[model samples]
Target: MEEFIQEAYSGIFEKELVKEIAETAALIDFEEGDRLIEINDYIRSMPLLLNGAIKIMREDPDEGELLLYFLEKGDTCAMTLACCMGQTRSAIRAIAENKGSVVMIPVTKMEEWLGKYKSWRNYVFESYNKRLGEMLSAIDNLAFMHMDDRLLNYLKEKAKVNNTTVISSTHQEIAYALNTSRVVVSRLLKAFENDGKIKLNRNNIEIIAID
Candidate 1:
């Protein structure tokens, strides 16, 4: 995990600031199926993801979960920012999508770190900007795209984010992201799989090709 942090910082922060922040970080590991934070739950401190991914979702009338996006390594959870601003009842739910490690930083300590480390502060702002952009994009898709179109586009986007046409996520999870039902997702996925565009592996569905 230290290696991952070093790598993440090497790409994003000054070496000295990286060491300072890493030194102050306390690793919190979660198992694959853990629920790191539920809907509307508030955090007293901020957490930095060091390894693996978490799904950020909201409830929809059509389903169990609606995936807003993901918090990958080097990304901070949106809830952290919301909590910092003293907001209650987050519209997003954060669940551990896989085995992961988080660095929980006390809000006071984080403020001190930001004060002492200029580069780290800038890095945080840049990350938040990227997240805000993604949130806006999600809103745009939800407002304009058809459910099937959204699902296909989302799978395509996730493929791009992972740098491969193949990813190990599930139809139900994808449905959650699309704000639709897994049964409908399954029907579409079965057709895609039959058409040789993807393959299903238990809970994980891999898109083999887009075209």
Candidate 2:
């Protein structure tokens, strides 16, 4: 628990605060390909990814799992707020894309912790703002940008955040993120590969140029 707290926080709060919350939380371990949250399920708790990867996705008739995004070690999935706000159904499904661990805090307890600890409140505010920003960015791209610009921008931003040119997501996943078709994503990847800007290896695509 101390290790998880240490990895998650950078002195944003006193160690005591994190320890106190951790004492009341549960550590959930997941194997690869486990569903942590199903669509339309009531989200009773919030998960902070402690290790490995979790995928947040919306299922589609044609595309299957249209990935909304991922929750890495530092990420907290946003669906918990909907539940706490009295929503009965989850908008996305959270699945363990890889073997992982998450620290689960009851939504009620988390609210209590936030009210009692100013630092925790601040942390929650910051995370909320980050999510808001991402949503705004997505809306902006969808409304104003061309498909090529949006797709390239997405790839560049994703690569930047992951600190690598290689992205392990599939074409259909990127298409969903960019609000386009898989064929469009595939065509763009082919163009990039032909121009020596990226490489395609079946389901995974690599952006050869860092920019």
Tens digits of per-residue lDDT for model 2 on 10-121? 5775787778757877898999779889887987877777787776776666655544566676678665665655747787878776777888878777778777888878
List where candidate 1 sits over 4 angstroms from the true fold.
1-4, 61-63, 87-89, 157-173, 200-204
Question: What lDDT would candidate 1 get against the real structure?
Answer: 0.73
Q: If scored against the real structure, what TM-score would every candidate get? A: 0.81, 0.81
lDDT of 1 by residue, 84-179 (tens): 556465666677767778887666666776778777688678877888887887888889877767777778866754556666777666766776
lDDT of 2 at 144: 91
The residue pairs that clash in candidate 2, if any, are none
